[model samples]
Target chain A: MRHDDLCHEVVSNLPTHGDCFVARDATRNDSGAIMDDENKKQINERYEKHLEKGERFWPDTIFRDLIMSLGIFTLLILLATFVGIPAEPKADPSDTSYIPRPEWYFLFLFKFLALYGQLPVIGKIEWLATVLVPSVALGVLTLIPFIERSPRRHYSKRVLPISIMTIMVVGIVLLTLMSEVPTVSEDGSTLLGTLQTVVGIFIPLTAYVLLFVFKNNTRLMLWTTGLAAVSMIFISGTVLTLAPEKKTEETEVATTLVDQIFAGQDLYSVHCTECHGDDGSIAVIEGVEGLEGEKITPIHSRDVLYTITDSAMLEVIAYGRPNAGMPPFGKTYGGELSRSEMDYIVVFMRYMWDDRFEVPQEALKPLFPPLAEGEVPSYNVHILPIVKRYCISCHRPGKDNNNYLMTTYEEILTTGDNAANNIIAGDENSYFLQVIQEQPIMNPENPEEELIGVMPPTRPLKPNVVDAFLRWIMNGMPRTAAETGALSTTPTPEVTPTP
Target chain B: MWKNIYLWLDERIGFNDLNKNLLDRPEPKTTWWNTLGSASLFLFVLQGLTGIFLTVYYTPSPDHAYDSVQYIMEGVAFGWLIRGIHHWGATLMVILVFIHMLRVFYTASFKYPRELTWLIGIGLFLTTLGMGFTGYLLPWNQKAFWATTVGTQIAGTAPYIGEFILKALRGGPDLSALTLQRFFSAHIWMIPAALAGLIGVHLFLIIKHGESHFPTKDD
Candidate 1:
């Protein structure tokens, strides 16, 4: 419609609140139009009829707009404050194990491509789903104005477009919901995959075709759309139910500087402490099999700290200095640590030893809560942290610890060559207790040889740590704080009577 | 003094004309759904504000991008709040823009004299998604990195110009510092410029044609 007609429509609509300038301004703004006069006249009259009952935009429409905008602002703040963005580790291109998921809105397209790939013969054409399908969909969406050109605005007159869009939207939503369900299961079962394909592709495609065929019959088109939508949802629901439980991969992402520093400290203690010593002050590596007595720069020294950039340090850790005794500690070089772990190690080094970076006080908390006299230490509270810091480096898998792995409480109790005698509850003679106490278990078979050498051969455990272990094992090893609390004999620190 | 100041400003700025054309018009009795367009505009402004704040601390290079964001979260006052809003606003804007389009579609608002408006709306929608795609890589974190890698790779699967598209998107074969820089530029400057321009046109069209009225069966 012409600009004058729009103004006339607005002026004619608001009889209660008339604007005198509208008509004059509308006429002034009037210009040539491409639309034929007859069609424009009809549209203008229809809009004018609607406007006769319409409200003024100033107080009525603008009020709602303001309220909605305010509501949205409030929701945004709530979401920002409560469900904050989750922290992810720094990108590591070499860490191919990291699963790449697109933003949630694109998950439907991602799922559609996955399902389309399951079709026989044509499934191998990667571009069909990735490029062509999306492009075609976008093209169709963009041309919607011209495609269904009938000016019939009522739903009954517009059955075909509405139904098609409904089915399309439902399909997109269902596909996104089923994105996490694998097209093919690990055991090669394609049942869930078939169900998803039917929901995601077959039903929607068939419905669109059927809707076009019955375009003149409004009732039939609606039925087809409704049936198609229901069945698709039903099938997707089944697929979701039958879908295997996803394994939650817990990647530790330290967001705060203090957390990163502590994470770095723990990693360093486990991996670097053997060669670099606890404080990274070891000038010569000791106790490591072939690298024993190997001369190396003290890692904590200003020479190393000031000279090596973080990236360079990362490289040195990832691809170890071959001429020196340092073994690769990054996963890319066949080591145990991921890129994030290695980054944490660097952050830890800078904060703790580098004079330039001040360490956060929270990061310097004791490895475990100090034990009271006669109180028992649980594996959860005391042993786990201790084992992680002192034992797991060599005792973990692939290390020369006689198959002993202290990574878990169960592993500590059940693993190792001498599992039966590893941590015998209530027995101070347990191999673990004896070893940590600097008493190596003598090989009974060859009375002259020591079987399990003194634990953490590079350094001895502090007296307090050894004493905690002695009390813990002697009182029967507890797994939880509750269990340890029951075993405590500290007499509850006699509550004094208050007047 | 206030009346004189108001008179001077009104005479210069044409406040009466703005009110007559823009605000003091008639709209068909609107429902809550009618507010979606304005809500989307609000979100765009919010996202723009938060995004600007983010750029103050967010480095676009691979080397310092992650560290800079971490420092923002840990060191800067209310930095987390700002980044958080930007992050979530992007998501909300995409959803609102999409639903706004759907509402327009369902009401057949794209028909007749408002066809140009519909076309501009489509442009706005696509640019909104473009903004999302580019802004996602600024964090330089693992999810952003790998997702962009796969996202660009998907773009690269086109029949003939696949390699060109991929290289153009990434600025190279891989998602390196260059890709981060490119994405950052597009996120902050290029796509946003397109979005703002399209939105201007969209608003103008809406004002020119007036909001579409709810349909009724009348011959």
Candidate 2:
């Protein structure tokens, strides 16, 4: 931009105006070399004409592209909703053998794990490959385009990035395929060696190596990318076609204690045995800490079993006690249940409860303590435990729960969850009280009384025992053992019915 | 109330200065790709606000969990809208994170001074995903209950430490009120707090260096 550097035509265009002189002006010869004006005038005239003509900048209907993209997105959402996620019914903690796999988006990584997961001690290689490699690879990917320092924008010039992305896609496909088809077993021979064909992975991997070798060849990379995409789809399709059938002929597996009890035994060995003595029994009252300041409860007590139902018991089994030394059972909760099978659990619980076992049998009185002051004699000893024994089997937590017999002590003292809406609390008018009171245990001699789904639905208890509970709630329900010590151990005054 | 309050408050550092130190710092010359991280931050704010609104009426008790959520969806004013915002915001955050990572990769920003930030970003992204994973289980419905069970099962498969991971997550030997409570705590505090700390360090590192050198030949 120095005065001497201007074209000859631009220097002549400067007029001799007052006090405004170009450095190239003839006055005083101040470096009078500059572009002459005639050429500059011509160039400026041509540019002015170009602007006066008014060129167009944009096309009409610009909204169409955006509208179309939004419309497509909305339609896809509707379609996906129709596909809808699958959901299971209320979870049963008692059933511990549920197999879990991720959604399809993560299936490729999952398949990778399946292939390399059990790799002879060192096979933890897949975890690093899947987690760390993908993570680091993705990290490098974010920084790479900037790092390459290539001024060119087109793929024709950006050789390294394109090749790396291609190889990455191929590697993912191979790993996913390997996970799905880890072996060419007998089933592969069934349909033209389908499993072997599924394991048909050599060509693509070879191509990946070839791509790395010939990274600069644009034509080869393009062709290989096209081929890889098609193969990925085809392999994924074959996997879907050959995957184990979704609906296994519904095997009517009997839900029984055999498997669970045994599974429980093995589970206890790793998790519970140290604290609860290989049985459910904890010497310390639960919520009361032992020597190690661990809160624990013994399982053998009748009070504990009555306090919670079978399903509740299963939850306690599967998830270990909190604030207590009891470690969680089963891998379901991230504990040691990883080693045991379901069949072993049933055997453990059954054995623990067996009467022939040599366990402490302190006086029954210690097992069932006296009612504290203001605590009802009928409830602490007779009524509540009986309800726990009978009604709670169906109505307790994790069960049928049509009537909430898992009612708290506060609930026993006041209204139930349904409240005055369904049951009138202690009023004989309460539907639950009415139903249980009127229903017969199992009496063929009485015309008004036969078997009824009274409460437990397991087995009816002694009739006088039922009568004792009914009398307490039916009356004003006086409490406090000091006030009614005579009724403490009195067999029910009503005639005991023979079932 | 005044004397003790003044003494207690005065003992602490200036809250305004603390905030200024974090937010009012200079921004380097970031490219378009760096915008996704900001987008993720926006979505996180959206989730936090919507979540707090949802929690106002949500009852966590198992018997009532399903009912409470349905009530939010059908009965509460603007509840469904807020929920839709939160849910879609979660998905959008995931997408934004992926885009941000891709942008960084395409630009080679993970190199040199940025590597640790990249690693921390990776951890933050996964923690974000984990937050999304664990938060859905709180409702204790059919979908939340089992989906989370399956999710925890994936953690249960982690080599060697998988079992410990699952147990710590579940809060017991099984999924219970304990699991829900622990997850809620994590969703609210652990993951979000981790994200904040990680993001603070990430931005701090970015400011320490010049904006990543844009691709140019012999410039």
Pick the TM-score winner.
1
| Deviation of model 2 at A396, angstroms | 28
Model 1 lDDT at residue A249: 82
Model 2 / residue B139 / CA error / Å: 3.0
State, as a TM-score between 0 and 1, how close model 1 is to the true structure. 0.91
- Per-residue lDDT tens digits for candidate 1, residues B105-130, read 99888888899999999999999999
Cα RMSDs of all predictions?
7.1, 20.3
Taking all chains together, each candidate's TM-score versus the true structure is 0.91, 0.43
Clashing pairs in 1: A13-A51
Q: Which stretches of candidate 1 lie over 4 Å from their true place?
A: A1-36, A372-376, A420-430, A437-448, A478-499
